[model samples]
Target: MEAWYMDDSNEDQRLPHKLDPNVPVTLEELQKIGVFHWKLNADIYETDPELQKIRDERGYSYMDIITIHPDKLPSYEEKLKMFFEEHLHLDDEIRYILEGRAYFDVRDKEDRWIRIAMSKGDMITLPAGIYHRFTLDETNYTKAMRLFVGEPVWKAYNRPADDFEIRQKYVNSLAA
Candidate 1:
């Protein structure tokens, strides 16, 4: 996993968000900002009781696996286009990488992009209404577990102008 300021010139300044695998942060610190990361035990499995307990505690009602590769993407071109495009959902977007790598470009408090590179054992949840986009990293492949609070609804609002004001206010608040 990796995180850094997107602006190449300001490499030394610290951002409001942090990207440290060793630092432990609170749930409020995570959920309010619309982004969170956690490292899991390397040997974790889908059927593990610990994972199930987490699911129950987090209110996740369903889960599914998604694998993507160049060969598999041809048949999923339209769907891939949607994901690569900047968009937000009405519910949090949660993913746990079971294998491979991908980058999730999430908008910061200042509306700048922060690219989060994720790989195996990295779990992330992007809170609802935050503008973000996803794409495979250099490997061009990823296998992830998608979790949902209820039945899944794969709808994305592609930069809807009407909600920007409200969403931006919420994002700003998170920064505060």
Candidate 2:
């Protein structure tokens, strides 16, 4: 996974809008904001030991695959718009990329945007209540496995969700 500060460009969102100075963000720094990452063999992900261990440890009992593309998705444009909106979830947002690539933009403690580029074999878990957004990269396609602790929840509270308890707890976590 590659991460860096997103440039404030008005160009297409699919294009890599890397910052001018190219400041990179490391996995360790991402951890400070409650983001977790792992790289696993996508081809054998169903039986991959590392993935199994993570699921077991995290109590992820539900899983499903989603293909995001103009042709594959019913309301591709609508969905992409929603996905790109800064939002927070009541539960952790977990995704394991199996094909194509995308970017996950997360807000740092100072509210700066850090774009995380993810591709096949990459798995990322954005802890509950982190204001973030996702979008397909230049390829405009991605197949990902979504995991959940139990029943899957698709609700996303658009930003300015600071009133929520989950958001409060997340802010407190960063203070720690």
Candidate 3:
């Protein structure tokens, strides 16, 4: 429910990522995510058993959607505000966008936030202690692929992020 988009132009400027969603993003806008070298498994997208299992999981089903409103539309900002804030706990900020671009504001080791931009088809491996918030630039939308764990119960969790910590068993099972 963090969505707040006012029709007033003056208010919009004060908000982050000023543009409405997904009309289109340029090369310059795409360069912000720093540089990470992550590849995609062409075969797994449609045929991976692991991914298929995850698709059936409750969390994945809720967040994974292929279609979305263009970032350029008037309601774009309002839409983004809703998506990111829906699950805003910093315990495990695990995500990777597969078909568009997004900017992540993460608190680095020094606790100073570093804004890293990520493009479609990039894998984001976030370590612990990083606080992050995400954004999709104006005129742009995305189809993202992700990974996370489901906790049946809390077992001495230091924070909510502890619940999302990727288990080695799950990570090892994934085929490269």
Candidate 4:
């Protein structure tokens, strides 16, 4: 729903003094609180059949829930390309960057692409059907934590995007 940038990143966002320790988290707490992480809920997604196929092929049932971390990623462009092109079956593509820099380009309902930048301690939640793309640079050395809100569990990027065809059988299977 929102992106949270590192506290130190906003040197000008600080307040005067601290707040009452017993008080609830307030403006002063927010301004002074360091950026830690971000998260997305699962109730927002609308499933796609392709996602179910990927799950079945992977010896899983549903691409229901998943988390993504950039730093722990492997170094494979081909694999990365496929990973990115495949649309998430669960619909809501969520992420929280723990470290580094990156940008996400997502397609809206009107077919418009919107790019949201992410850095350490940033959070982003992508609603279902919002086609999305992500890129990481040398400076993009980042680490992220993700949460998926679907059933079974599980579920990235590179190269020119590819088209994914949906078969009627798979759709029917998913519907059932």
Candidate 5:
């Protein structure tokens, strides 16, 4: 996985949350931000016993595949546009990369964009209401498994809106 500050001109400078160059991120550092990452040994599937156990424990009731590539994206062009735009959901956004790569640009407490590049076997769960967006890496391809606790809804609440006050406050609390 690759991560760096969005504004940084030098791609070689890898930083977590762009907090400091001297201070490498520790396990605590990652946990503090409410972003959970995990490595999977087997392919994730709704019917897989392990995945099902996780779904049951996490209250996830829905699973779907999102494939993005030149040929497959045309039908989803409109939706993909919105996906690339900064937005948040009322529920946590969880994704497991089944194939290819994608970059999830998430905003830190200070509002700096942290680009999290996910590849095969990488799984991430972004807390609800965090300002974030997604785009395929240079390869322009990604197939991921999306998990939801309820019926999946594609409603992406754009930023600077009042509708997500509760979630916004929760996200702000994590900063402190």
Candidate 6:
């Protein structure tokens, strides 16, 4: 996993448009904003003790796998558009990359965009109601495992969702 300020280029979303000055975001910085990351052995993830411990500790009882690729997903373009839309979920968004690569852009404390580049063996947990978006990197392919505390909720509230209690809590966390 790697993170840096994203350049405001109109090029393909898959391209790594690293800012010219190359401001990098450290893992500690991500944690300050409620984003957590882990690196696990993807090949043995199914039986990895570390992953099992996380699931057990976090009470993530439900899990599903998704492969985001033009050939694998129906309405691929539409889905990508939706995924790229700045939005927040009612529940924590946890994903473990099992294959390929992607980028998760999150809003920093000052609302600046921090792009997190993830690849196989990478795992990330985005706290509920944090404004974020995801897209495949140059590879245009990614297989990920999604974990949930209970039944999965697919609903996404597009930005300006400040009214939601989860969003409020997320904002308050930043101040702490």
In order, candidate lDDTs are: 0.72, 0.95, 0.43, 0.40, 0.72, 0.95
Residue 113 displacement (Å), model 1 = 0.3
Superior by lDDT: candidate 2 or candidate 5: 2
Clashes of 6: 0
lDDT (10s digit) by residue, model 3, range 75-173: 766766654441224234445566666666544223333445566555554433333455664536766655545532212223234245443322232
Per-candidate clashes, comma-separated: 0, 0, 13, 3, 0, 0
TM-score for each prediction? Answer: 0.77, 0.98, 0.46, 0.44, 0.80, 0.98
Provide the global lDDT of candidate 4 against the true structure: 0.40
Query: Compared with the true structure, what per-residue lDDT tens digits does model 2 show for residues 1-176?
Result: 99998888878878878988899999999999999999999999988999999999999999999999999999999999889999999999999999999999999999999999999999999999899999999888999999999999999999899999999999999999
lDDT of 6: 0.95
Tens digits of lDDT, candidate 5, 1-176: 65655664544222223544522333344557777787674363545676667778899888888788878867655655667688888778889898898888777767777778788888788887778888776677898999998898677778874457756575776858
Q: What ranking emerges by lDDT with the best candidate at the front? A: 2, 6, 5, 1, 3, 4
Candidate 1 vs candidate 4, lDDT winner = 1
What lDDT score is found at residue 79 in candidate 6?
98
lDDT of 2 at 24: 98
Off by over 4 Å in 5: 8-27, 42-49, 75-78
Q: Write the per-residue lDDT of candidate 6 for residues 29-116, one digit (tens) a residue.
A: 9999999999999999889999999999999999999999999999999999899999999999999999999999999988889999
Indicate the TM-score of model 2: 0.98
Q: Compared to the true structure, candidate 6 yields what TM-score?
A: 0.98
Worst 10 residues of 5 by lDDT: 10-19
Model 4, 53: alpha-carbon shift in Å? 33
Q: Per-residue lDDT of 1-176 in model 1, one digit per residue for the tens?
A: 67644543434222223444333334454455668887765366656776677788899898888888867656655666668788888788889898888878777666666777788888898887788888776576888889999899788888864356556665666768
Superposed on all Cα atoms, model 3 deviates from the true structure by an RMSD in Å of 11.3
Location of the lowest summed lDDT over 10 successive residues in candidate 1: 8-17
Q: How do all the candidates rank in terms of TM-score, highest first? A: 2, 6, 5, 1, 3, 4
Give the clashing residue pairs of candidate 2, or none: none
Q: Tell me the lDDT of model 4 at 166.
A: 22
